[model samples]
Target: MEGVFDLERVATFVAGYQSVMSLESAHLADTARRLWWKRMTDFWQLEFHYDRNDDSCDELYIADEALLHWWTERLDVVERTFAGSAQVPNSP
Candidate 1:
């Protein structure tokens, strides 16, 4: 489901998933790295917009590109969050 980025929601979702099956926190950290790498290496969105002469996915491309920057900047915090080592604000 697509929605605004919320770290707390992400943590909750991960915790929920862990309830069903065991997942190593280290795995989450590794997955974050892999995702970042994939984002860094991918240009499909740009290809679609520029090469394919399509604008339908422009907004998505922009959002994802921005997200890549955001994620890169907060990579450490993200890894910590995934590993349950960072403190997330308590939900009200």
Candidate 2:
């Protein structure tokens, strides 16, 4: 029997995965970095602020509205991609 993959659940999982592994583990550091980069690039168009003299930079914070929409779309894409991958066997 083929196992069912819930997009919503998988999306939630991905979000949690991204959150927990974003900066803590080397294994997932790259994946988290890519995700963050994509998020910033897509919405902010790579616009950012920096203080040359202070050697400080603005932090990256996702707006609530944007985060909701972005997560919804992101989860859908991730779930679909995982579902479609041959390596991820449908039943196993």
The local distance difference test score of each candidate is 0.75, 0.42
Instruction: Note each model's CA RMSD in angstroms.
Output: 3.3, 13.5
Model 1 agreement with the true structure over 24-78: per-residue lDDT tens digits: 8898989888988997899887898889998788778767877777677778777
Model 2: which residue pairs collide?
none
Query: Which ten-residue region of model 2 has the weakest summed lDDT?
Result: 83-92
User: What local lDDT score does residue 88 receive in model 1, on the 0 to 100 scale?
Assistant: 68
Model 1 backbone overlap count: 0
Which candidate number has the best lDDT?
1
Which residue ranges in model 1 land beyond 4 Å of their true spot? 1-4, 89-92
